[model samples]
Target chain A: MSDALPPGATLGILGGGQLGRMLAMAAARLGLKTCVFEPAGDCPASHVANHHFRAAFDDAEALTRFADACDVVTFEFENIPTAALDAIERRVPIRPGREALRISQDRLTEKNWLRDLGLAVAPFAPVDDAESLRAALDRIGAPAILKTRRFGYDGKGQARIATPDDAGAALAAMAGAPAILEGHVSFAREISVIGARGLDGAVACFDPGENLHEGGILRTTTLPAALPHARATDAVLIAGRILTALDYVGVLGVELFVTDTGLVVNEIAPRVHNSGHWTQDGATIDQFEQHVRAVAGWPLGDGRRHSDMVMENLIGDDIARLPEIARDPAAAIHLYGKAEARPGRKMGHVNRRTGPAA
Target chain B: MSDALPPGATLGILGGGQLGRMLAMAAARLGLKTCVFEPAGDCPASHVANHHFRAAFDDAEALTRFADACDVVTFEFENIPTAALDAIERRVPIRPGREALRISQDRLTEKNWLRDLGLAVAPFAPVDDAESLRAALDRIGAPAILKTRRFGYDGKGQARIATPDDAGAALAAMAGAPAILEGHVSFAREISVIGARGLDGAVACFDPGENLHEGGILRTTTLPAALPHARATDAVLIAGRILTALDYVGVLGVELFVTDTGLVVNEIAPRVHNSGHWTQDGATIDQFEQHVRAVAGWPLGDGRRHSDMVMENLIGDDIARLPEIARDPAAAIHLYGKAEARPGRKMGHVNRRTGPAA
Candidate 1:
């Protein structure tokens, strides 16, 4: 295990999206410098990081140079080319480890891994071909979502099936890639637990946020999710189990479905998650700082939300309201600095505080 | 007057000290880009700004290049050699204006300007020679401070005259420079108001913070200062008067002395003030962001102090206690990312919240 990093240490971050931009800024707050490695020129994170390695993620020489400069390495996203990680991990430590990345990268593997740990998750089965998909559909039943095993995000690369007759069309929707057939849980509400694991074995979780989705994209997340105290404690404990089981060493976002039976895990992200953005305003030390502290081997921060907050994502044209939003005293606007406001793009988010909860 | 700046606009900051570093970070948080212009390499702000202009402040070519890139120009320090500001001001607007800078850059000018505005300030006199110094010392009385009219800060370039015998020595300390001898105001406590004025001429002010100095350097600033409601209102009004008189369009830090009679103006800083650092944790929007918004021609932010906080400067070796401080869940650390822990240097600051006040 690596020792804790000093203040002046350089943190090498892969990817230069809004997540990386926020991460770099958080690292700066703690006296750590960040160097961002991104293929795109003038990316969001490049404007804030201490340094920018403008090169592809798969470039071996660039990865070597990056690792040489960084005391420890971390990534904002999980889709980093495994070979690039292999090249850098040998030279420097990568928090959340390769095992966590490998498992979280595939939907079928992640579901099976969670089931093996005896955690409750949605019923899912692997579907590699049309025959396998047909067989899995028979076993998992109709009214399922067929999602690509890898690189699927934001309702992309996924098709919903209503009946057995629609199965072939759903399989074709996968474009012949590996897929997973997941049985939908009749959830009453959706909530997410943002948790962090430190360099030591200790784990800490922030208050869960009740999530609302529109068109398969996150619209809002309300903090202190109106869950029963016992259930809220269970959500935190479940997130801890997942982190400890994966030997995770960073902030993880676990999206859960609040069903009639109990809480069921829908997915887990290995880095700072969108649902945890409320912590930026409501918590003492936010999820971005938590991720930085964990990756730097520092102890986890206080996870309690000091105030009640509702986070709303500013997708695409929602940015037009920024001028008026800027005048709102209750809202804290966090824009990603993206140039183009394409439809469905994650432009930014606003955290509106609802006062401190007793 | 300039229109409001959009999120992608670049802000040109002239100075790369801790103030600029914090401002750059704040601009990044708002999705605004910043380029730092400083003569020194690897300065604190350089690490966080999107672009670094490593040239002297008076470098006309560099200033021109910088102005061409920026939508507006603002500065962290007031001593930005008038010629450089002239070069940049022709290309884009500089918030708080050159008039504010000219008055605040010199002690005598600032005091006179404040006194002319029907404000309460300590009795003072400008001294150009030893004879004038003796005359002024006699008028202002002994047990006073003889300070350089220009470039005096952190109690440097200042000498104490305890008695008539000490007059000559104190005058000699200026080393052939203009000086100001001001009579001391025996005050109850020191307080400062951080106020912001946007392009639209609306003023917003944070609650006053009680300041404590050790060895002529700011040690800590406590928010929601122990003051009567009327005195606080007077302080805010006085600050607004100064802002309106100067036609200011950015955050201003006004130091005041609470005397038996009323509030006496100590001095005013034209940019974000160290005493206002508590707003970063205690308020919805901080002084840094307020300054950014004002300079960017945006509306002022909410200046309410949401929580009680005490900001302690991590000067020099004080940073050694970071590990212990980090363990204190209430303290949010903001390090400037300086490589060395030089004596008396402000390496970082810690904001310890005392909880939300009623």
Candidate 2:
């Protein structure tokens, strides 16, 4: 590991979404400054920070200035160009590193990494063209998902080939992008383990949360996941193994499927996840703070939730219910500084404190 | 008393100190925009806000622009000029309005207001010059403090006159400014009631915190003060009375002396006080958020502390001890983004959480 970053040092963030906004707040609490880089004019992180470079990822001058200003850099989203990271890494250290990025950016590489780490993932095959699509379908069989190998998120750029006739529509819909076909895993519930790994190989995991999705967007996350104790232990161990192998230095979100037989890895997020929002009210240190502490080389705080928590995402029209939500004694609301409530956009979230037993 | 600032509107803050920084963070959580106006470069509030105006308070053009950009204006420091508020008030309402400033800016006026409000304050008389100082001493007696009527803070611009021979020296020390001579209160403890008052006549108060001062600077504040339950209740009621009588629209901090007879009003801070820093981690809703909610015309939150707390200020060299403090499970540290650490300058603070019973 490189030299530790002292307090009052600057942290460079690659994306300026709500995740970066929360991350900046956490960094400030630890006496660290944040310089957020984003392309949007009124990104959420800009409101809470003064040092912002509003330039595209390819702007070398801006990138150089950002690298020069920060002691270490981290990204809020996984879609950051590897070339931009390469240019900055020459000047400053980037935590969670580029190795994790390369594997997580593409679905096929991520799946392979999971399997290589001795983790159970869905059966999958790569598809580059019509011939490969047909061959992969023959191997994975029907009722498989055809998804772009790169840049697919929140259920976008994916289609289901349920029958022989649907293959043409699925292939045409995905266009010319390199893709992957995966047989669906029979699961009873969706759960995610949000945990952090330090440079010294210390792993701290938060309680797993049960998640619900609506129209391909996360709607709510409730703590005390439905998984059995042994299954939860296995889920955390799998996540820890992946982080350790990648030599990750920040929080990693592991999405899992709780099947009747066993737990299977669904996907991996190399940064703080939306499902971890409950930690802000329920735990001693939230996921953002934990990520900051891990990256800053501070000892990770206990991620135990003191009380049960229910976190609900305020998406588009759901923001209209803020007045009612504000009146609830058990609820704590957080709204991002987005101007318009567009469909599928994350506008805000409300976390409600529940009974400990629940 | 003025047009209600709705949830989506912006709140303007005059000073960019830690109190304003906390206020801006609080406003962000409520879906309200915060615009901080301060002359200094890289002011504390500027780092955690959506908009910041780097202009002097008396700059008419800049003040007009700032006033037009905000729905309501509040100040973090009481020494702001009346003319500045008059300009902003012509455009938007100023919360904890001009009356508070009028009282707080002049020691004589503040003393008279406390007496007028049917509250107990130190016996005092005005002194414009050496002749007047002698006259004031005859009425108030010796062994009292001679303080300037305006622009004094943290024991500065004041002198303790122990004898008739020291009256002339104290008067000369004040540089012929308007002043007040007051008999000091002998109290068992020093405590402050930090609370917020909504425009709709709602009031929320946190438990009183006993304060300790060193070298004329506040060093520590311990919550769940040793005062009797009846006295704590009286303190909250008195703070509510002052907030209502002044038509206060935001958080008001009332510092009191817990004497053997009863609680006496020492002074009123029209904005958040340093002694309330513990609320950042201990209280469910901090004083900063409470002020933002009151100014935004939103309902007040439960300002109860989840645990007992002791907040210690990190003055100058004290900041170097943060690494040891961070290792403690109960410590919540906050650092202001200040470049220099001059003697007696506040650099940051640490809040240590203890169980409520402590």
| Overall local distance difference test of candidate 2 | 0.85
Clashes of 2: 1
- Expressed as tens digits, the lDDT of each residue in B155-188 for candidate 2 is 8899899987899889888998888898878999
Tens digit of per-residue lDDT, candidate 1, span B231-333 = 9999999999999999999999999999999999999999999999998888888999999989888878869878889999999999898888877777888
Write model 1 residue lDDT over A160-278, tens digit each, in one string.
99998999899999898999999978998999999999989779999999999988899999988889998899899999999999888999999999988999999989999999999
List where candidate 2 sits over 4 angstroms from the true fold. Answer: A129-143, A161-168, A226-231, A355-358, B1-8, B131-142, B162-169, B356-358
Structure candidate 2, residue pairs in collision: A47-B49
Candidate with top DockQ is 1
Residue by residue across A33-130, what tens digits does model 2's lDDT show?
89999989878888886588899999988999999999889989999987899889999999888898999999999999899888899999998888
Which candidate should be chosen as best, given TM-score against the real structure? 1
- Supply the TM-score for candidate 2: 0.93
Q: For candidate 2, what TM-score does chain B get against the true chain B?
A: 0.96
TM-score of chain B of 1: 0.98
- TM value for model 1: 0.98
User: Per-prediction DockQ, in order?
Assistant: 0.66, 0.43
